[model samples]
Target: MAALDMLEREPDLAFSLNGLARALKVTPMALYTYFGSRDDLLQALTERLLSGFVTVVDGDMPAIRRVEAWCFAARRFFLGYPQLLGLLTWEGGNTSVAWFDRSVVLIEALQELGFKDAELSRAIIWIWTSVMGAISEEIRNRTAPHSLSPAQVESLDPRLHKPVRDMLMLAEQPDHFDSFFAYHVERLLDALRAIAKRP
Candidate 1:
């Protein structure tokens, strides 16, 4: 994570084996001992990041609650290491198991709520995509603004924040936020339940 942070902060610096070795106060040969190559080091870093998610999930929690916590945990993890999002395209050897286990738990929870296997799979995919897509857009907007002018912000469409804004505003009042998430969860569960009931 430290090496990745340095790379993110100094994109101009060449991120090679020697460079990283120097940054870590180690000889290039020493790094090669632990990681066979530059790609191997990157793979190790990716695995470390993925494995951290497993530690974030509370095994003692109910499956539904665990799913909710996992979603939030994932969001927080991705937000912290936005640069690591690019690593998702590459296949990490043992690191992928954490994500698969989490996904299975989520699917199982939905299935317990009476969703058909196929429908539960689709719902899980849709929910995760929606949340991650929203976070990605927010990160991109905050980091790289196409138009810096004040007029651009003023002229921007308000409709973009309508859904989230409304939710936030309502959630400000006591107990509303809890009710809001519960409402959405129930709606999602009901939809899945309907699919399960379908002949």
Candidate 2:
């Protein structure tokens, strides 16, 4: 859709039927023929954005590893389309059919490890939230200007917030985003592994 292409090219542009119609060289009423309302259009855009999300993983791998692979792939997908940040993080974000399609991959893997009902649901929520959080943070770090400089950190009172000062200093260095992402992914996998082994 031309509207989707416009969004991908300029993500920050506020989405409106009027704006989209103008971009497409059509009247707002023309869009109403396709989308019932703004909410309908938003859902369609989200579905289109996430339709390609579930890439094939090595099915022969352990179920836990397969799920882990899904998490990493999800990270890459978000990074590729940072515009999804606003859509997926807000209200009604997970209501679209594509969201369930992507989530079923993890659900099946967790089911293979004996998870069911609430436990399975909780695991899915945990993994999805973690991936979304990491991707959001990574995008902010890359696009937003650093708030504190090394010199600013040096000027802080020595008696206060040592860890904050230290963190600021470290923040000045190149971010090891992949390594940081892998660490959290491992931690989440560890928790899932424990859950799978429960009596």
Pull out the clashing pairs in model 2.
none
TM-score of 2: 0.81
- Can you write out model 2's per-residue Cα lDDT over 65-163, one digit (the tens) per residue? 888888988998878777666665446544665676787768889999999999988888888888888888887887773566667766878665577
Each prediction's TM-score against the native? 0.53, 0.81
> Mind giving the per-residue lDDT tens digits that candidate 1 earns over 1-199?
6576666676545445566677888887887687776567666665665665542445566655655655566666666666555555444442343455546656666666565667667878876775566557545644663333445444657674455555445645666534544565556545555665677
Q: lDDT of all predictions, in order shown?
A: 0.59, 0.77
Q: In model 2, state the lDDT of residue 171.
A: 60
Poorly placed runs, candidate 2 (over 4 Å): 11-18, 89-94, 145-162, 169-175
Pairs of colliding residues, candidate 1? none
Error of 2 at 52 (Å): 2.5
